[model samples]
Target chain A: MSWQLTEQDLPDLARGAAVLGTGGGGDPYVGQLLARQAIREHGPITVLDPDELDDDTLVIPTAQMGAPTVVHEKLPRGSEPVDALRALEKHLGRAADATMPIECGGINSMIPLVVAARTRLPVVDADGMGRAFPELQMETFGVYGVPGSPMAIAGERGETTVIDTGADNKHMEWLARGVTVRLGGVAHIAEYAMTGAQVKRTAVPRTLTLALTIGRAIRQARERNADPIAALAEALSHTLYAHLRVLFRGKISDVERRTEAGFARGRATAQSFDGQHELELRFQNENLVALVDGTVRCVVPDLVCVLESEQAEPITTETLRYGQRVTVVGISTPALMRTPEALAVFGPAAFGLPYTFTPVEEAAVGTTA
Target chain B: MSWQLTEQDLPDLARGAAVLGTGGGGDPYVGQLLARQAIREHGPITVLDPDELDDDTLVIPTAQMGAPTVVHEKLPRGSEPVDALRALEKHLGRAADATMPIECGGINSMIPLVVAARTRLPVVDADGMGRAFPELQMETFGVYGVPGSPMAIAGERGETTVIDTGADNKHMEWLARGVTVRLGGVAHIAEYAMTGAQVKRTAVPRTLTLALTIGRAIRQARERNADPIAALAEALSHTLYAHLRVLFRGKISDVERRTEAGFARGRATAQSFDGQHELELRFQNENLVALVDGTVRCVVPDLVCVLESEQAEPITTETLRYGQRVTVVGISTPALMRTPEALAVFGPAAFGLPYTFTPVEEAAVGTTA
Candidate 1:
């Protein structure tokens, strides 16, 4: 089914996308403002189902690439993504049938919405990553053999660069990262142009609709004076992420963070009220691994999300401050993302974590109970 | 006014280009090999006079960009410049009628010739900078109102990037420099796409012919046992760079050099035979300022060249070694390039030097004597 994503849906979409962000993809609030302003000016955007498109349809995924910490301070001019889209279109000499999120997380999820609203192109209700990972090549589209170029990157003042390289996706990321750093640590990019059939085969379908459902659940729970964390878990119970575990409920004790090489790299530590239980989360943009009291409870290819203890509002890596009350949650990733081939691209070892790939269900069993 | 540039002209062209390089623009020997091989494979290239071009003729300038030190080790595959040219042509939907050197210095002077040979485009007998400077914006085309983009850059492995920015030329250099570093410290670029009228208005005219004359003068001087340095000055006396002075004749005492931020930057000191006079040459790829006994003898937008004291062969910055006997020369730049408008872009202060713009003639007066 198709749907119209109006101004009313932005708040819920942002909240839900942030949850899926798993502590990366930049702050959703900033992206929400850009998307809302674009929607108000250009009218609502249409969200198309991945299955509804013909195989020949061209789909371009658009996102923000840079440190989340920097994106917070250097607000985009709100036209960079559209500029990138137009540049790519000009280079290809063909208009994109639709735009989609490269990753369904925080700002990236909203970026495609902003581009779609401005360009009057429908956004597909799917994404390359159902839950965000840090690097470009970690996406299913890349892992499944789709090239990330010819990619277009745009800066705030209308400076645009189009890269068409014979290099692999990793090299593309390296090249684009260098450009992003030169563009003041942030850039809007449109890449991984794919046909509809490729999208259907490689993308995490229904993630956009899934985000809206999760957002609605959290909102409804908060309205009824119920537990939002429980609502969030319940929302995931019927979806692809069927296993949800609250890894730790506590206040942030410490955060050692720095913006280096165009990424927000750091670790955050959360301690229980009694200080007996501790959880350490390591990240490079998105949370890669979670260790609970020296035991590897959750690792990448799975979600390690931190949300406010009460309201269940998600906390981005950039916003993980000391003394903040939070509930760390671990959710199982979709089956498609957990396959051997998929894990090879984004699994625990891919992030230099020493642990092997373990399902969130198996990893969280005794501890959550 | 036009001529055929065969493999036979390469040695002379390279030698003259090295003189004009003013101690930068990569090693001419490497470029000579590439151009010679290209000419051998693709036949002789036609050198076109700027005045003969139709007003609407598209003339693209090509050059090698990176620290000259790196280019010595990472020889290009001889195809990057043509790749960049083709990519730019594809982007603009127009074929280039001719190719020209962005600078008439060292490897860059030979780059366009190589492109012209491979692509069958005529080589323009002109250049943006008659003498090389380190940065991209220090060119007559940029100083006199031509934009440096839409520019195309190509790496050795066929990776191509096209930049179209609303930012000024300096920012474009910054953006492109970052890409160059990621492309392994060297890239072939085609930029400053100008019409024949613009080329005629802004580019330094007849520089290709001037370089060949300089080379011939040195070769004949060496063969006749005449003073090569005197021959070099005589060669320049008939050209735009008419004022020439041998600033210092000495053995190199010390060199403080390092590659940083994608540039080979350093200072070299030379002491006269009697050890009574010392000259310090400050360079960032190309010699920028020369101080004889702590007094400014010559600064940029003028030519500050270093050559073997005996042979008069140009010595690039990377090749400047301790104990080498050398003669430093200063020559006046073309009057067009010495204008206040041009000075604002490539003058002393533009390079963050404390001195003001003084014609090399006036600055060198009484110093050499």
Candidate 2:
């Protein structure tokens, strides 16, 4: 948790962020390039302890909510977070001293850094959710009652939107993505304004540290020619090292997409070395769950990620198509994600699937048996 | 604009709300019953002029956001909106002087009456949007920059959620629906805190008046054995109407529904007129557009309503199915809907159709050409 972010941290952050993205966080490269660009512009971010802020010090947590594929092609206005942050400060009559990631996967991790550098606010070493999720309320913060709005979305059009609804964080996620769709799929959002007291109470504290550590593990594993999955397990405290089933490392056989109420909804059918398996992933802003063979194998709050086996690179939900070889991997949902509230948000029933939640590893083990 | 409500007004409000629902919005029956129950519980709602309130008065708009189909089967935990509104008032440190509909169609119309009677607040003669939309941010207030959070959602589980994220209203919709999906597709939301000044300047003032009038027209037409469509045209200042070919009118052939990212993304195929023609309506929360003969007949922001011809009853999106002889009518998109913003949100392209915004009259007028 004490590890400082160095220039060497980017690769790991990107990988871990992708894995954590659960499949819907836009392309990690966009987030990576932005983070790298911000780091290059403002120097490496000084990760602060969650408890380091003064009681009155203001903090802003930021993220991106939209179609991940759209994000890579459209790019951000770059000034969105800064504009949103400034608008928020103006509304609140104070300036945020630090910025934090709303979620630390994919574009969200980098978006906070961009905002921090642009506004000259220090980046916090914490995030709301340890991993990525589809809706705003899916964050660990929501389980702890940290609201997501009265926050702002800054668009490239130089407009800043603030939503103060009587709904919860997930409502904010819906509203924000609607704007993102109108804004052409990438909207920089700065939300979850809190004092140090509230931040410590609700946030997934040291999430940035976890992200960094996980990032480091992946990078080191690659460098050492060791198994990256084992490295990830070593980093996560409660996680156990498990053998992976190269479920299907083959081209996507079919893809069906429908843009409904802003989130892209669809499934991808893939033909791997093992034969044909349909990988159905539902998403909002992040991948919520994946159904293989009409069985809920991985549900949200859990990471259902698709990576290129050859390069170990991340594949976003939007880019998933037929004829693209993808290695399907299942990572255990974090403990923070196992809470009853969290399950209710991203579990099988949450997405209207009839099956109840059984952890991915246990379910996979059961299936194999 | 200064129309007052009487007991006789309820019939129109119910009928009008259904027409405005555009094939979504839960059954008007529950909402009607709730409104009637509220009126019976506490006399008629005092319909106040939008200008009656002081500029500084706090006003909260509220509604139920979830699957319309679920609303009927699962009766509300009646006390949720009351709890949420009260909680929101407590958070704002003020008693709201009035309540209003976020949108004026379907469940939204009846909700304000219930809240008004429950909380003893006057129901404003206005709303954020003129008609029902699929998402929270599609309201006029949103386009005019009304915040959607610091809102509360009270669940039947005896939980109250207060969200204050910096996301846009669209994100608020996405996230709130996620909560609804989590809570079994129904959440009472209290959002859009506005002053009398903000409400007057930004909100579509007196749209509820229009809804009431539209409701009256339908009722009157039914009573007099006149054409309800003609009455609707007269009531809403609508200039365009298209009597298109009734492509199909039978039973529901099939229904495929999946809750993807909080919104119901599915298509309902219906067989009609002795199975001579087939009809398909794709929906998120509201049916955005309808395609008959592979041609876009009616796009959203306009009315694509299906009325049961024999009974002249408004058919909801949820209840639409095969074996139902539905008279599909096309109403022109309102002037507000033709704006670039409106087109972007619910226009043809928004519905993934390959046509520009054209009135149903014009679009269908050319079909015979």
Candidate maximizing lDDT: 1
Candidate 2: residue B256 lDDT (0-100): 76
Sliding window of 10 residues with minimal summed lDDT for model 1 chain A: A360-369
Q: What is the interface RMSD of each candidate, in Å?
A: 0.9, 8.8
lDDT of 1 by residue, A1-369 (tens): 788999999889889999999999888889999999999999999999999989999998999999999989989878999999989989999999999999998889899999999889999999988888788888899878889989999988898999987538878888899999999999999999999999999999989888888889999999999999888888899999899998888889999999999999999998888888888999999998888898988898899999988899999898899999998889998889998889888998788889998998899877732
Give the DockQ (C-alpha) for candidate 2. Answer: 0.04
Model 2 C-alpha lDDT per residue in residues B249-346, reported as the tens digit of each score: 45566777765655656787766555565667777767777666567766777677777776457787777665676676666644655678767765
How many Å off is the CA of B223 in candidate 2? Answer: 7.3
User: Residue A359 of candidate 1: its Cα lDDT?
Assistant: 91
Q: Find the candidate with the highest TM-score and give its number.
A: 1
Which stretches of model 1 miss by more than 4 angstroms?
A: none
What DockQ score does model 1 reach against the true complex? 0.87
lDDT of 2 by residue, A55-127 (tens): 7777888777776656667877567778778766765667888888888777787788777666667888778
DockQ of each: 0.87, 0.04
TM-scores of the models, in the order given = 0.98, 0.54
